[model samples]
Target: MQVHECVSFILLKDNQVLLEKRAQDKEYDPNLIAIPGGHMEHGETREQALFRELEEELDIVPTSYVYLCSLYHPTGELQLIHYYVITQWTGTIVSLEADEVAWHSLEANPLDIEADKVALAEYRRLSLSLIIL
Candidate 1:
């Protein structure tokens, strides 16, 4: 099985969170809303992975972040995810690797964005994490 290591950040500011709508052409389910983060590369720590993903996907440099948790999933496909909280960021958001970017209110949506709900249970358990598959 292919092992995938990733990270997702709950980027919040003034009660709003940064949400991205995945492109329709994305290998993942279309338009799924996700937090800002992605896979870890070889020899990369969780912070390194988070930084890389943030710059690659959104071109934003985070000013501050904190490790929140980690999860290992055995969803018939093994995957590990490192979750974090991005409380600060620099450089205005100018990249749109996703189909769209929106500053969403925490109360506006139900916060269910994953296709494989069970695999993402860990995130739901964390009050600060936005769970996903």
Candidate 2:
């Protein structure tokens, strides 16, 4: 199995969330909008991987953070992603590794990731599940 340790941030501010348009250079999710994160290199923990990925992708560091949940790829790849809530952060957004970035009011604007149907389905599941919980 192709195990990948990935981390995604819920970059929220006053109930808004940030989503990124994937760079066309990407083969896996080109032209899609998704969260900021990537695969963990060998020997890295989930938190370390997340911090490194967020810094590389978004050019910011969190002032406070915690894990929200962990989920697997539908294909059964292990150690898929640990979702983190980044409610507080430092610095500005620059050096964007994505094609574009947008802040969405998730409550009012539904976010979408075009090429990543699995992740999108996961997002939709979370959205619906949150309403009842």
- lDDT: worst 10-residue window of model 1: 115-124
Clashing pairs in 1: none
List the candidate 1 regions with Cα displacement exceeding 4 Å: 72-77, 114-133
Q: Which model scores highest in lDDT?
A: 2
Using all chains and alpha carbons, the TM-scores for the candidates as numbered come to 0.75, 0.77
lDDT tens digits, residues 57-131, model 1?
Answer: 888888887676666645445667677767789978854688877787765643444422322334345554543
Model 2 regions lying over 4 Å from their true place = 74-79, 113-133
Candidate 2 residue 22 Cα shift, in angstroms, is 0.5
Positional deviation of 49 in candidate 1, in angstroms?
1.0
What lDDT score goes with residue 37 in model 1? 60
Deviation (Å) of 100 in candidate 1: 0.7
Listing every candidate in turn, what is its Cα RMSD in Å to the true structure after a full C-alpha superposition? Answer: 5.0, 4.3
Error of 1 at 47 (Å): 1.1
- Alpha carbon lDDT of each predicted model: 0.67, 0.69
